[model samples]
Target: MVFTIKKVINNNILCVTDAGGNEMIVTGRGIGFGHKAGQPVNSDAVQKIYHMASMPVQQKLMDLLEQIPYDHFLLTDELVSEIRKKIPYTLNEGLLITLADHISFAIKRKEQGVEFKNPLLESIREYYPEEYRMGKACVQRIQEKLSVDLSKDEAGFIALHIVNAELNTTMSITNDITRFVDGCVKVVESYYGRTFDHESLAFSRLAVHLRFFAQRLFQHEQESDDSMQDQDFRRLIASSCKEHYECAKKIAAYVAETWNQELTEEELLFLTIHLKRINLSSEQTTK
Candidate 1:
């Protein structure tokens, strides 16, 4: 399909408006050379087309591209492709804008020797080991290709952005979820006087549960008590696994007070059961 050029970004990149009137960023070698607005670009010559999820993100990316070298854009595109292969979930298109813009700024800072440290790097590595590893690999790639060295802290930021893309959530919400899980895990560890295996299947399940649990809290969604009226069943489990139930109660209170959202009985029940398994497994191993 042919695209009408809206603006020429450079010799290799151009802002083109598709037939449907939506503005898109397209790039190819010499595609914009001698091109002007209202000019038509042959689809065959276009190598990459970035359809940003929102205009604000698109504008930010465009503004960044105007200041940074074209290599940054190409590097960001390659990184996104590599990250997609490493991740299990579908990444949102917004990653193109968000990640590209971030890399551009990071490169600029690196060139100027501006040091910015990420305080949550350890938390990210602990909670999202896979993504953090991917992020580290990305740093290596950037160093090799662009001759820019990004710190491990930047890797943490990249991993969180990857998480945001995978979850289709904003960076703020992703950070909130990461902190929420970290806090809850700390509570469990402190209560049992032991650390849970982050790689174990039980711990993975618990992390997944917390991911969704935090999502609900962020969205202000709650389970109705009317549907979970089986107080006797909950009480039976709580009575039998009193210690685990109490631990879960403490966690529930933590989430409630921290997020200002009450945890439903069903949530408390499932959390207690999961913690019971974790606690039992740890005890068995210790004995």
Candidate 2:
């Protein structure tokens, strides 16, 4: 199998996806030497991937993952313990390692100013007032809890985790999407003390989809559910995603009218990709 590497940093870490749809974290100084965004890598090299050591400050490592990425980097256990104590997320080896890889890439992406598209670009403030509030609150919390200064991107990462915890029992994004919509509606209604109306529905719909799609894009099921394949489950997923996004768009439009602030470009970018996936019509939802 041949894999195309889309991103690389420090001439070490890589994000590669193969024809078989496997995305993995690979590390080595020379790995990126001859590579470019669309360059293909040999499967044998992928199979040869090795494990690395963990840091003494893994908790601080977790903190950085909550803010940025750090693959094969040093960390403190106290920092790891502190974050583990605060967040209810299960702390295990796989999660710890994956997060380390993720944060490193995300930090590199941040430096590049990757803009997110908001489906509620016309009226995001009304649809996701709570997110706006949460964004503000996250900054405050980071300021008080963290010893070092962090940027808006870091605050947003922290906010994303909070969003994840509220809707998901496990990291499985399928379950998260189903619950995320209901969760967003509940939070917004309580915040404004009223349920969403039709006018703001488009924006609200976008909000839920973005939250769902962004989280799922990076997640993969470790094992295939035999039952899901036996029963035409891909169709189910595709239709459900379509419904989810359509509803989210309707919700976003509704929120725009309710809130007064403008939606950021970042939000719209996320919404757009989600909508695109759902709108693929007849394509298998899961790859």
Candidate 3:
């Protein structure tokens, strides 16, 4: 009932082949530290292994993953299972290897108490009600159903797909994105003595910025590159933010006046975020 530490790699994953030609892909964290290949892997370093339906391979992999005691908020099985739902060809070696690193970093970030300011905070609340609701709805309507308990991260991914499809991604739609750009330009021109057309440097730059921003928002990736240093950009953000701020307040008033619900900090933040993006005037309208 003994095992040998096959090898340790710096990339935070272990490729171990032991007694009887059984191999395991184990996550590297708090595991046989400062040790190299052939260094006997201590029993308490492994968490869980990629289990297979094949009983022999499954049992061996399970035992290998079990040698480690503490779980570090990552389940490779969970991630692999989840991603496989969307991209059918994700079971390839490349995805397995790449996602292993991705999952590790994400889990480690959570361990460090890092938080993302969810832009869809209100929709996540008053709109979707809960993460499970959106996730389950997407899962239920799956073109390719996966019979796995989808993780919250997985559900969030699916929810994003739904959002993207709702928002059209095209050149004309991007022109609609430019309409908001025009509004911001007007706001900026009214403030500054500098005169410039939408085709000018200031407006062109911000328009490009907003085009990308709108795309990311539709994709549900709130954290994208949208800076506000130049005058036009700042003005654009200010105009956009002001509109959203007003919309948030309006929503707050409605929720309080009608629904009788007092919106919390989390709820209001995302509401403001989404409203600003939605109000940005995208050609998401056509096609």
Q: After superposing candidate 1, which stretches have Cα over 4 Å from the reference?
A: 19-22, 53-60, 224-229
lDDT of 1 by residue, 1-287 (tens): 99999989889888889889999888888999998999898999999888777798788777767777788889888999988887778888788678877888988888898968997888888778889998899899999998888999989889988989987888999989999998999989998887887777677778878877887778677565565578898889889999989999999889878877788878888899899887766667679
Q: TM-score, each model?
A: 0.89, 0.29, 0.26
lDDT of 2 at 174: 28
Q: What are the runs in model 2 whose C-alpha is more than 4 Å off?
A: 1-72, 75-79, 88-93, 115-154, 158-287
The models' CA-based lDDT, in order, is: 0.85, 0.44, 0.43
What is the lDDT for 73 in model 3? Answer: 21
Model 3 scores worst on lDDT over the 10 consecutive residues at: 122-131
List model 3 lDDT by residue over 67-96, tens digit each: 432232244445445645654222333333
* Pairs of residues at least 3 apart in sequence or in different chains that clash in candidate 1: none
Which is the better candidate, 1 or 2, if ranked by TM-score? Answer: 1
Descending-lDDT candidate ranking: 1, 2, 3
Best by TM-score: 1
User: Which ranges of candidate 3 are over 4 A from the true structure?
Assistant: 10-13, 27-29, 42-45, 51-287
Candidate of highest lDDT:
1
